[model samples]
Target chain A: MLLSPSRLRGLGSRVPPCSSFRPFTAAAAAAASPTSKPQVYLSRSRNPYLNLSVEHHLLQTTPPDSTVLFLYTNRPCVVIGRNQNPWLEVNLPLLSSLTARTKPGDHEPAPTTIDLVRRRSGGGTVFHDPGNVNYSVICPPESFDRDKHAEMVVRALRGLGVPGARVNARHDIVVDVDVDVDVSESDGNHGANTFKISGSAYKLTRLRSLHHGTCLLSSPNLGSIGPLLRSPAEPFIKARGVESVRSPVRNVGVGNGEFEDAVVAEFAKMYGDPDVFCEVGDEAGAVDGVEKGMKELLSRDWIYGQTPLFSFSTYPTEDDPRERPSLPSDFHLSFEARHGQLSKFTFVNASSAGHVDIPSSSSSSPLDGSRIYDVEDWTDALRSYGGTVNSQAETAGRWLNGLFGTGHAKTQLR
Target chain B: MASIARCVRAARPSVLSTISKPIAATSRPVFYRPTQRCFSATPISEVRKYTKDHEWIDLHADNKTAVIGISEYAAEALGDVVYVELPEEGATVAQGDSIGAVESVKSASDINAPVSLRIVQSNVELEEKPAKINRVPEDDAAGGGWLARVEVDEQGLKEFEGLLDLEAYKEFTATLHE
Candidate 1:
C-alpha cells in the first residue's frame, strides 16, 4: 500500500484510544541500549500496510544512527532481493493474474491483494502479507551485528510462545512438522521435517545504514515459491512441481490471541527507544529516495541488466547425428572471467544425439541414447581412445567443486 | 515514589559535578608547553596511522611488520561490500598508492596502502569469503583474515604523524552523523 508518512500521521490522529499502546519503560529501554531502539511508528490506515518504496525511503533519508520500526497489517506483497533477477525469482503468470485482478490507481489493495516490490539486498525471493509482518532495522554499520540482530528477532518470536525458534546457519528460522506418511514403520510417521518460517538477508551501504530481511508469522503459499523462480537449466524440473528446499510448518497466525498479543507487546518492548523520535522532515526525503529506487527496480534494464555470455560448439555422434534426444557428444567447455572471476561457462559438443556422452561411472549419465557404463568402464573406454582423465566432471563433481570455487573466488575478490 | 525522587536528587549533584570538573580543570590554557600527552601523536586509536589521503595503517611491534584492514568507519560508508581485491604476497606498495580494490554491492573501492611496504601475506580467506572483511574486520590483528601484511620503510613512519588519532576520528565520525 502507498503508506506515506503523512498518510500515517493523519490516520494516527483519527484513531481512538484503542490505538494508544504502552510505551516502553526506562529500564527496558536501557537494556536495549547501544542498538538504538528503532522508533515505533504505528501505521494507521484501515489496512495498516506499507510498501517497499516507503521502507526504502526510510532507509535512505533516516539519520545514520536512527532505527525505524514499520508496523503494517492486512497487506499482501512479493519482495525480491536487490541483486536478484525478478524474472528468475517471480512467477510471471501468477503475478500477471494478481495484477490484473487488483484495481488500478488503488493506493491500498483490497484484502487478499498482491504487491510486487524489490529490495536493495542480495538474496532470494520472499512473499509478504498481513498474516506476515516485515521489520527492517536500519542503523549505522557499527551498531548492527548480523547474528545478534537475528537472535533478537528469534527472541521476539519466543516471547510469543513459539519456543525453539532457532535460526539456521543460513539465517532461516524453521519449525519441525509431523505429517502422515505411507511408511512401513509402526507409527506410520517419518522423521520430523523442518519447514522454514522466516527468511532473512542483509545489505550494508557506504552510508553506514544497514537493511536486512525479516518475514514473520505468515503462512505463504509454499507451492507458489517454486513456480516464481525459473531455472533455465531445469525446465523439466519446473514442469514438475517445485519442491520446497526447506520443510513446511504452521504459521504464527495459527496461534491464539494471547500469542499474537504477546508478540506485538514484545516487539513494542524490544524495539522501544525514548532517546529517538520520528523526524517528520526526513520522512519526505525518504519517500523521494524510495520512489527513485522503485523506478530503478521496475526498470527492465536493471532487472535483467547482465547476461552470462556462453560460447560452445557441437559435434555429431554416429547414433544421433540428425538429432540427439538426450545428451550431446564431443563437447568442449570454456568459461570467461568478468570482474576477475568466472562470469560465464560455455559447453560445445557434436554428437549424433545432440548430447554429451557422460560415463555412467560419472555422477551424470549421458544425455544421448548411449549405453550406460559405470565409472571404471567409462574410464577404460576413454583410455582406449587415448583420452586422458581430468579433474573436471560434467556432473555432481563439477557442481560440488563449483560451490567451493565460486565461494573462494568471491572471497578473494572481497 | 518518594524513594525514586530522593535517588534522582542525590544523583543530580554527582552528574553536575562531573560535568563542571572538565571546564574548571582546563582553565590554565598552556598552549605553548609541550605536554607529554599519551595520544599527542595521533587521536584516532583504531585508525592506526594514516596517509594524507586518509588511508590508515595498523603497525605491529618492532615497527617493521603489520597487518592491514580498513577502519570500521571506512567499511560502513562503503556499504554492502561484495568483493575485495588485494595485492599478491611479495608485491610492493608505496604510501598513498592503490594496492587493491574493494567492490561493494553498489560500487567498487580502491584499497590504498597507508605506507610503502612489501606484501608479506595476503588474506586468501577473502577469495572464497570476502564478507569476512565486513563481518570480522577487527580479527585481523593476529594475522588471521587480514587483507595484507607489509614491511614499511622508515620514510613511511615519518608520514604517519599526519594521520588522525582516536579522538580526532570520533569527532570526524560525529560530524558525518550530524
Candidate 2:
C-alpha cells in the first residue's frame, strides 16, 4: 500500500510507519489493502555471480529512498572497502586455496566468483555468500543517519521475534547461542560497547547514498571462510597468535530455517516501508556510475598505485658474526651508541691457544692507558693459568666494574 | 567444497535451536523507501574547458597557467574524498597521463593531467591529512588546500580547444538523468 508523505501528514496523528496505520493516499483509500505481505525484499542480492553491469546500472540509476534487499547465495567471496587495497587486507594464500576448490564443472552458471569486489564504501573486508543476506538502504543524505538507520534495522529484526536480537554499536545484529560458544562474552560486550560488528561502512554521494552489510543468517563454510579471510601478519605476541586471529563466531545459519525466515521477514518489513520504499530495477544513470567506478576499480594504477612501501631492519647477532675467523688471535668488537650514550658492546674472540687476558690497570702496563679493562688483574692471572682463557671471570669483572658488554670467548687448550 | 556445504547444511538445525524467540509478539508494518536525485549540472564559462574524464581547467588571463580540478558533478559523484595523492614538484607529465589519485571511503580514482605541464607545487597538507580534499577540492594557495600548480606546455593550450565548453558538457551530463 502506498503511504505518501502528504497523505500520512493528513492522518493528523504522527503514527510511526511500523504501526498498523491506514494508507492516507487517496488512491490507496479506494483500493482494498491486503493485510498479509508476500515476497519481502531483504535488500539487494549479494550473489557473487551478480552481473557487474546490472549492479552498476542499479546503483547509478536507482533514485534515493530506494531500498534494495539482496540474498547472497553462492561460494565465498571477498568484498573490500571501496578504498582499501585487497593485497593489504587479504591473505593471498588463503584466497588461492578457496579459488583452488573451484572445479571446471562446479555449476551451470558457476557460483559467484570469489576473488574481490571493490564496494562503494569505506568499511573493512567482509566475506559474502548465498547463506548471508546483503541489505542496501539507498536514501537521501538527510534521511540517512548512520547510527539511527542501523538501529532501526536491528529493531525490526528484534520485532520479528529473534530473541536477544540487538544491534551492536558496530551496527551488526547479534544473537547469543550455546553450542561451542567460541565467541567470548567479552567480545560481545566489546561489540555492544564499542559499536563495531564485522565492520560496517558507508558511502554517500550528493544525490544517491548507500549503507550495505552482510547479515550472516546461516553458518557459512567456516573451512573456506576461515582459511580465506585470515588476518595479515601481525607483530609476534603470544596472546594474538595466528590461531587466535583466525577464530571467529560462525553465522546464525547453523540454527533453524524457521528462525531464519522469521529474521528475514522482519528485516524485509523494516526495509519495505511503503512510504520509504521505491521499487526500481537497474537504470541507465546507476549503470553509468557503476561503469565509471568499475573502470577505476579495475585500473592498474587505481588498484596497486598507492601501496605504502615497507622496510624492515636486520642486525647481525653475536652467534652469527659478520666475518669468519682465519687466525687464532683474530678478534672483533662491535659497539652501539645512541644519543651519545654507550648502549651495547659485543666482542668475538677466535683464539686457539693463548689466554686472552683483559687486565684491570692496563694503564699500569703502558698499554692503551685510556682503555678500561673489564677483568681484574687477579682474575686475568687465574684465567691465564688455565691452558686457554675462557673467562666467566672477565664477564663477572665486567659486571662488577659496570662495563656492560656481551661477548663470546673462543679458545682451544693445548 | 561440497562437504563443507554439507557441514553448513547439517548445522542449520542446531543454529535455529539456539535463537531466542522474537522480542515483540505483534509484527510491525513495513518501512517506506525514499526518492533520490543525481547531480548533473555542468558549469558554464567560455574560458573554462572540460575533460571527458570530468575535470575542468580555467586558464588564467595571463595564458601561462591555469587552475584545474574535477568538475562539480565529478566531485559529487566521487563522494567524500579522504585522501589525494599529488604529483611532485618539478615532475613533467603528459596530457591524459595519471598524475595522482584521489580516494574516498567507497571509491578511488586517478587524477589525470589535463595538460602536459611541469608541476611547480603540490598541496603538502593532503599528504599529512587526506580529508582536506573532501572539505575543499578547489582551494588554492590562499586556502592551503589546492592540489597542485603546473606550468602548461604550448601544445596543451592548443589541446584545450578540443575540450567540452560549459554548455556542451552540461547538456551531455543531463542526458544521463533517469
Docking class of predicted structure 1: incorrect
Q: Name the runs in model 2 displaced over 4 angstroms.
A: A1-53, A64-71, A99-114, A169-198, A223-227, A230-250, A254-414, B1-82, B85-128, B131-139, B148-178
- Every model's DockQ: 0.05, 0.07
In terms of docking quality, model 2 is incorrect
lDDT of 2 by residue, B28-65 (tens): 12222235221212211125666666566765544567
Return the TM-score for chain B, candidate 2. 0.65
Query: Which candidate achieves the best lDDT against the true structure?
Result: 1
Error of 1 at A108 (Å): 21
Give the runs in model 1 whose Cα sits over 4 Å from its true position: A1-38, A42-50, A72-78, A85-117, A177-191, A206-211, A230-250, A254-264, A271-286, A306-414, B1-178
The candidate scoring highest on DockQ is: 2
